[model samples]
Target chain A: MSWYEQYRSRYARLKQAGKPFFPYAVFKDMVVVSLILAALCWLAYFAGAGLEDLADPTDSTYNPRPEWYFLFLFQALKFFPGRLEPVAAVVVPGVSVLLLLLVPLLDRGPLRHPLDRPFWTGLGLASLAAFGHLTWSGYHSPLINPTVEKDPLISRGIRLYREMRCAYCHKINKKGGNIGPELDRSAGSGSEEWLAKHLRDPQSVTPNSAMPKLNLLDDEIQALVAYMKSLGEPFTAEAPKLFTQNCASCHRIGETGGEAGHDLSLIGSARDKAFIKRYIGDPSKTNPDSSMPGFKGQLTEVQIEDLSRYLAGLGR
Target chain B: MIAWVHERTGLDRVWKALFERHVPEARGPAAWLYTLGSASLFVFLVQALTGALLAMSYAPTPDHAYDSVRYITGQVALGGFIRGLHHWGASFMVVLAVLHMLRVYFMGAYKYPREITWMTGVCLLLLVMGFSFTGDLLPWDQKAYWATAVGTNIAGQTPVIGGVVSRVLKGGSEMGAATLTRFYAFHVLVLPALLAMVVLVHLFLVVWHGISELPERRLQDGDPQGP
Candidate 1:
C-alpha cells in the first residue's frame, strides 16, 4: 500500500477503536487555529505600515535605541567597555538562548505537575524574574547621561562645562591640566582685542592652534568674555598648580609651551573675557576645530575664575 | 473518485499501490505531541505568504528603507496591522519551534536514526534566527541600525576570523547601505531556499523512518504521556 493509504487505514482503525485521529481531533483544533491565523492576516493586511528613510553612515547624532523587547540587551551593552563589549552583547544572550533550547533535556522527569517538580518550577520563576529585572534595568539606563545640570551663571557655566565635558583637553589656572591651554592665568593679562580675535579665528593668529574659531553669537561672546575677565589674581589664588604642570606637556603659551597646541600669543587680542569664559565653558559650541576640551564641572567656580585670569594674563 | 483513482494507472496508481501494500498492523491514539511538527509547518506557511506580501512594497535601499517603512505604516491600507502580524508571527514561530524541540527531547525522540532528524531541526532553528536577523535590518530605522551595528560588532569578535566575518556580514567597518542590501538578500533568498530544502529533508526522514511508537507500557495502559 502507498504510505498515504496505509496512514489513512491506520487512522481509520484508530477511529474505529474510539481513539482520536489526525483530521478528526487535530482538525478541530485547526479550525480555531485557522480563525486566529485569519485574524492576524487581516490585521497585517489592513495595518498600512512601512519602514523609514535610508540610513546615514556619517550621522553619529542618531540615537539608535533598540525596540522595547531588546531594551535589556541595549542597556547591558553600556556596562561593557572596549573588549568586554562582545562578551556582553553576544556571548551572554547566546548562552541564555542555548540554555532555553535545552530546557526539555534539562527537565527530564516524569512529573508533569508544577507541585511535583518544585525545583524546576522555582528555577523557571527565578529565571523569569531575572530576565524581567535585566530588561527593566536596560530600558532605563542612568549612565547614558551622567552629568546633571546646575544653575546660576558661575555654577551654571561650571555645571554646563562639566556636563559638557570641557576640562578633558583644556587647562585652567595652574590647576586644570592641558589638552588645550592655561586659561586662568592667560586671561588675567590678555588683551580684549587678542581674546576676541582668537575667539573669532584661532587659526588666523596661530596656524597650528589646537583651538578652533568658536562661531559664537555676539551675546554669547560677551557673556563668556565677562566670565574669563573675572578670573584674574583678585578673584581666587588657590587654583591647583598641579593641573598646569600635568597638562602643559601637550599645551603652550606665547613662544614656550608644548607642541600639542597652538601659541596663545594674540589670545588677548582675539577675544574678550566673556567670550573666553564661554569658550572655556564649552569649546565645541564655539569652535568645531578645538581640540581643547570644556571645563564645565571638573573645576569649581573659584578655580575657573583663577584659570580665566591666568589666560587673560598671557598678553601682558 | 474511486473509479478515477483505479483507472488513472499512472503516478496515482503507483501511489495507491504503495499505500495498499504498506499498511501497518496496528494504530494508536493521535497524541497532542504529534501536533507540534504540524504547528511549525503552519507557521512557516503563514510567514511565507505574509513575507511575500510585505516584499511587494518594501524598498531595500538604505535611504528609502526607513521612509518606505514609514509610508507602509502610515499610508498603506492596514499596513501596520499586517506588519504587526508578521512580527508577531515570527515570534510565535520561534516559540513553537522551541516548544516542539523540547517535546521531542523529553520524549527521547532523538535516538538512533532520529539523530539526523534532530540535526536538521537544529539547522532549521538556526535558519529561523538568520531570518530574524536579516528581517530586522530591513526597516532601516534607528533601532534597526544600532541593533545590527551592535550585532555585527559582536560577530567581529569571533577570534581569528572575527574581522572577516563582521566585514562579510556588514559589507564594511560600519553598518550602511551595503549591510542593508546583504541582509535583504539573505532574508528573502538565501534563508527561504535553505529552509525549503531542510523542510523537505525533514519530512522525508519522517516518512522513511515512520512515526515513533510510544513506550510499551504507555501504549498498553493508554494513559496520556507525561507533560
Candidate 2:
C-alpha cells in the first residue's frame, strides 16, 4: 500500500478506538470564545477614542499618567517612599504573584470541591475584594493641583495637563524645557478648534509624530483647549510672513513651532522685524558658526516681509 | 589502636539504630498535590540563577540605565533571552507558590504544626513582591521613571512619614539618579538575600514538620477510620 493510504488506515484505527478527535466540541467552544473576545476588544478600542499632541519633553506643566487600566499601579505609587517606592510598585505585585504560585503547594487538601476548600476559597475571595477596592480607590484619588492659583477651571485644566505629563515633550513658558513645540504662545495664536483637533488626533495634524491618542472625554478635551487658548492674549499686528516661513524651524511663537532655536516670547522687544529679516536672510552675518542655518533662499521677498512683520507683533 | 576501634564501632551502631528506628515500614499513596512545593522550589532556583546573571550586565545609573539595558540585549551573548527567561521565571515562581498555598489551605495542612509553615509562606510572598518592586525600576526608561514617580507620590500621601518616604525614594522631590541605585541595591542585595534566608527557613520547617495527613473519618464505634 502507498504510505498515505497506510497512514490513513492507522489513523482510522486510532479514531475507531475512541481517542479524542480534532475539531471537536472543545474546538467549537474555543472558536466561539475567541469571537466573543475579539468583539469585546473592538468595543474597548472604540471606547478609548483618539490620540493627543506629540509629548513635549520640556513642558513642566505636563502631567504624565498611564491608561485607566494602569491607574491602580499609578495610584499605589503615591503611597510609597524613596527606596520603598519599588516595594509598592514592584514588591507588592511580586508578592501577590508569589502567593499565587504558592497556592497549590500551600493548599494541599484532598478536596476538589469548593466546600472542602473553605480556607483557599476565602483567600481567593478576599484577594478579589481587595483588588476591586484598590482599583476603585485609585480611580477616585484626588487630582494634583498646580503651584500657582488661578480661576478654578483654568487651574484645574493646567493641573490635568501637568499630571498627564504633556510638558515632558512640549515646551510652554520660558520656564519649561523643550522636546516638543513651545505652547506658551500657542494659546494666543492657535484657534480653539485647531487646538481641540490637535489634542484629539495630533497625528492628523503632523504625521510621524510620537504623541499617543489620549482618547480624552469631550469635556476633558474642551477644558484642555480652553486652557491652551488662554495662554496668551491675541496678537493684533501683522507678523512678518517670513517668521512663519523661516523662524518656525528653530523657534516657536506660541502653540505651533520648532525646538532648534530659542523661543520668541518677547520677540517684538528683543529684535525688530528688520533685524529678524536680516538674520533670516543671512544668519552668518550674526554668528560665524551659528547652528541656525540661514533660510534666505527658502523664502521670497514678500513672504519674508510678512514673517518679519508677524514676529515683530508677538510680544505685545 | 584498641580504643580508636571501640569508638568507631560505637558510632556506627548509633547510626544504624537511628536509621532503623526512623524508617517507615509502609509508604502511603503519593498524591499530585505533593508536587507543588517541589515545583515552587524549582521556579525559585530558576529565578535566582537568571537574576544573578542579569545583575552582572545591568548598569544602575540614570544616564546609562536605558543604554545599558539595550547593550545587555544587543551586545551580551544570549543576554536578552536570559533576561526574558528571568522575567518569565519570576512570574512562574509567583504562580507556582500561590498554587502550592491553595493546595495546602484546602487540605487543612495549616492546622497544628503547619500553621507556622503557612505564616512563613505568607512572609515569603511579601518578600517576592519586594523583589519585583525593586527590580521593575532597574530599566530606568520612561515607563520606570513615571511609574516610580507615581509610586513615590503615593508614599508622600501617608500622614506622618509621607514626605520623608517620598523624598527618600525620589532622592529629592522627584525621581532622578539616586532612585535607580536605590532600587538596584534592594533588588540585588537586600531582597534576594532576605528571600534566600526565608526560603531556607521555610524549607527547614516543612522538613521538620511532616506533611499533614488526609483527614480521617469516624466509625460508628467512635474509632478513627482510614481512607
In terms of DockQ, which candidate is strongest?
1
- Candidate with top TM-score is 1
For model 1, the stretches where C-alpha displacement exceeds 4 angstroms are A1-21, A35-316, B1-33, B211-227
The positional error of residue A188 in candidate 1, measured at the CA in angstroms, is 32
Candidate 1 global TM-score: 0.53
Fnat for model 1?
0.22
User: Deviation in angstroms for A236 in model 2?
Assistant: 9.3
lDDT of 1 by residue, A1-316 (tens): 2433443454445434542233344564486468657766765566433343345343343456555555666767668888788787678877876765565556653334444456766776686576678778876665332232212343333333443355676665344557777666465456766666666688887689887666766655554555555455443444336236534566666455678865554454344456667777788999989988777787666666666655644442
- Per-residue lDDT of model 2, residues A1-316, tens digit only: 2433443343344334431212232243355445433543443334321222322223333345543445667667668866667678666876776765565556643333445556766877787566667768888776542222335556457757876888787776554557666776555567777778878898998687677889988888888876775565333334444455556667887777888887785565445567777987788997778878766777767666666655654553
Q: Under CAPRI classification, how is model 2 graded?
A: incorrect
In the range B27-138, model 2's lDDT, one tens digit per residue, is 2443445556766666677678877887788778876676677677668887766666666556556666766776665555665445568878888877876676666667
Instruction: State, as a TM-score between 0 and 1, how close model 2 is to the true structure.
Output: 0.47
- Each model's total of backbone clashes: 104, 93
